[model samples]
Target: MLLTKVVALSLSFASVWAAPSPPPQSSEVLEVENAFTASKTAPKFKSLKASAAIEVYWHVVSKNSSVAGGNILDSQIAAQITILNEAYSTTGLSFSLAGVDRVVNATWFNKVTDGTREQTEMKRALRKGGAYDLNVYSSGFVEDPRRLLGYATWPWDYAANPQNDGVVIHSGTVPGGDNAPYNLGHTLTHEAGHWVGLLHTFQGGCNGAGDQVADTPPEARPAFGCEVGRDTCTADRLPDPVHNFMDYSDDSCMTEFTAGQAARLTAAIATYRTQ
Candidate 1:
């Protein structure tokens, strides 16, 4: 069953991932597939009836160029930790970002000269760290799906071998300005959704099948302009909630999880055991 599902899924995404350009070009939702589908060998945690008390060790790997001043890195780390808590709180999941606990040692100290190259190297190094089962390595690859978070790779934490369960938020997406929601919790939430086994509600394209999860409404594509109530899949009364955490909505407008989504996500997490 898993093999057939994977094969069918691969064919479904063959065109999207193969494209050199970013996804959602024409209401087409370009997203990571096989993110939730895990192999039997991987650890699966029984569903937590409620929020499970877990300590998440966070190691922020930053480049010298990124930290213009000493405080910038501190501020960014603080901000990210807060957001992660917010998402967890929403779902009754609890975690703490252990400061500088396990830094995935990297050779590159200078600014990421090449966004693509930096992300690639970062993933490789993360895979080496056996600390956490998953690592969210956010640096320069947030905009492009080809880079994983930015055209890089899936499960950003390669070191842990957690597969496509990790994520990255590009440095360019510091929470602020007009696209804060699209920036801050966007990638993390999306990737975290993958961590919990949720797929892009719109599936691969805006018009057709993407994620198999039911409660999540289908989106025409990744909506960034903050068009609330925009429905790509009209089969139902409520248009696809593109702005929902599962959908690609702008920063501020994106909020709330459907009851169905909440239930599914909670169930998915129950299937995985801590690394």
Candidate 2:
């Protein structure tokens, strides 16, 4: 059994727009009602429900970090695991991953000191192994949660590389940790949004529909730098939902997922992850 949180995870994308575009900038004040508008038509969630039980096999790689021991990595992994389990529980899906199945073991391997060949090969090996598992079960979706390959390791940019369906996480960047892992859980939530197919509300560079989900408002860029509220994108008069998990906001403050996004992710997993 799993406990359901009172607040729903706010995930959304634009459905009307097809092509990617830049987001418009604004300085208008947004109201909650306008910020959140019910979609005329909602995407279906059958596909997500149909997604098969996903088994994550993490390939733990080491990089230059101040933290000693595996505690930092372990902590990062734990945080993601918690969020993933929570998401699966809501959809009545089972999620499990082999604990750090592989290790890069190159904590001391300085980029300048060591040749790139070994590291490149290491990443290739990880991908190959993950692909093998995807083929083994003929799973529709295969994901590598650890920060292997070339992806962001900090907590601020919660971006996922969709090409490989791989998730990169830096333990030091998560919130509560020192300077690196700031607002990490939120970052995980955001990247996980990408993991399932959600995009940034600001889109790329704040001009186009960041994710293309209708329920989520289009913003010029992420908010939070200014202590006071600011609206980057205002269609009518409502401010953007910069605080949404899909956006780059503080970890503790970000939350909420629109019904449409839930439907989209649910359908995505079911279509791709189904065994």
Candidate 3:
């Protein structure tokens, strides 16, 4: 079961916005969220939920003068916080940068993935705080750079993996950085959605519950570039959610999240993470 899921993850876009680079394999076997810690399987979230203001603490692991690997600028971290807040501005939820800490370690800088003992140990040593605050770990890479941009734990996972309950991101994906197409910082937005219990808009393909949000159209698969009118589910009246933040379109292409999504995400946060 793990192999089947992880292999499919290799094919899906990997990250919060999980639009990993195209693979030689087929899209049918695909996944969006990367395995950033001990989680190798996709999580299923069904109930519609809503949100509240969230405080975020930034835990930056780098190889600078500190104790891990390379470092990111304070300015860069602030900018990402700004972008994150902007993404949730309309959802009745707000994200503020509560604090910032940097640890210098080369081993952690280069590699961390889902299902790895190293990842678990790393998170255990570095993770701080509880469900009341969002813990974000920024590094140079996660799992396979060619396939994953980042991965985050769902709201409920915090209970089982409190130390691992946060989003792991590729440092290059920050805004104003060089990670093109995904450089705008929406990756955090996408991951934040998952952190609040959102599934990919294309999850379960063109059929079934279709991401469990009534407003979001069922997408057959992750859309690559932004094609405005692309429709993969001809049998369904709703077009593919190519532009949703949950889809794998380019950062520039991602525009909105449905009202239903906002409600469900809010509810999830409330259910899992108490104030």
lDDT of 3: 0.65
Who wins the lDDT comparison?
3
> Each model's number of backbone clashes?
27, 37, 22
Which of the two candidates, 2 or 3, achieves a greater lDDT against the reference? 3
- The regions of model 1 sitting more than 4 angstroms off are 1-51, 65-72, 101-133, 142-160, 163-165, 176-181, 204-210
The reply for model 2, stretches above 4 Å from the true place, is: 1-47, 63-76, 87-94, 102-104, 107-120, 128-164, 174-184, 204-210, 225-229, 270-274
lDDT of 2 by residue, 61-136 (tens): 4442334422355565566656656644544444555556434354322230112354345445564333212200
Using TM-score as the measure, which candidate wins?
A: 3
Candidate 3, residues 67-168, lDDT tens digits: the string is 223377788788888888777665666787878888777677767765566567778887777786787877766445444566777665567657767777
Whole-model Cα lDDT of every candidate shown, in order: 0.44, 0.39, 0.65
Error (Å) of candidate 2 at residue 116 is: 8.0
RMSD to native for every prediction? 7.3, 11.7, 6.9
lDDT (Cα, tens digit) per residue for candidate 1, span 227-246: 77777666666676655665
Ranking of all candidate structures by their TM-score, best first? 3, 1, 2
lDDT of 1: 0.44
**Candidates in descending lDDT order:** 3, 1, 2
